[model samples]
Target: MQYEFRPSGVCSSKIVLDVEGDIVRKVQFVGGCSGNSQGIGALVQGMKVDDVIGRLRGIRCGRRNTSCPDQLAQALLLYQSKNETKE
Candidate 1:
């Protein structure tokens, strides 16, 4: 399934990704550092959502306490939870 998240406290305004079973793919971020966001997207593509969360959840943007990557992980977790609840 495809999920789009509008995240808070991040440089990116939104993130869109495709998830199938445990795999996350085609991650795209809007309104952020274009190259970095796309690089992140490519790196996480085909990775498990849980794995992505584990690796990225605690990352901070310098002293701000949260980074765009961390927010993406949160968004994936939120999406997964909502999907599970629906099923």
Candidate 2:
């Protein structure tokens, strides 16, 4: 499944994900630090969604309350929650 999320409290404007079962197939972040976002997307490819979330959740960017990684985690959580309701 493919999911798109708009993230708040972060530099990233959007997160696009392609997941198969619980594994992440691809990730793309729009409007953030280019290198960091690309690196993150690469690292999370083929990783389990929950594992990604566990590793990234609550990460802060400097003084900000949320980072791109944290927003990705939130996006994954929202995806999971929405999918769960369908089953």
Candidate 3:
């Protein structure tokens, strides 16, 4: 499934993801730190959605409650929940 998420309290305004079952096939961010966004995308490719959430969740950027990575984690969690509800 392909999902697009709008993140809150972060530099990135948008996160686009492709997921198959529980695995993440691709992640793309819009309107964020370009290098960091690209790096995060590369790092999470082909990773399990749950694993990404575990690793990236709760990470803070400076004093803010969430970073782009954390936003990705949240996005994945939302995706998981939505999928679960459909089953």
Compute the lDDT for candidate 3. Answer: 0.95
- Highest lDDT: give the candidate number: 2
Report the lDDT tens digits of candidate 2 across residue range 1-87. 999999998888999999999999999999989999999999999999999999999999999999999999999999999999999
lDDT winner, 1 or 2? 2
Instruction: Give candidates' CA RMSD values in order.
Output: 0.9, 0.6, 0.6
Q: Give the per-residue Cα lDDT of candidate 2 at 17.
A: 97
Clashes of each: 0, 0, 0
Task: In candidate 1, list every pair of residues with a backbone clash.
Answer: none
- All candidates in order of lDDT, best leading: 2, 3, 1
Clashing pairs in 3: none
lDDT of 1: 0.90
lDDT of 1 by residue, 65-86 (tens): 8888999989988998998998
- The models' CA-based lDDT, in order, is 0.90, 0.95, 0.95
Cα error, residue 1 of model 3, in Å, equals 1.0
Estimate the TM-score for candidate 2: 0.97
Worst 10 residues of 1 by lDDT: 58-67
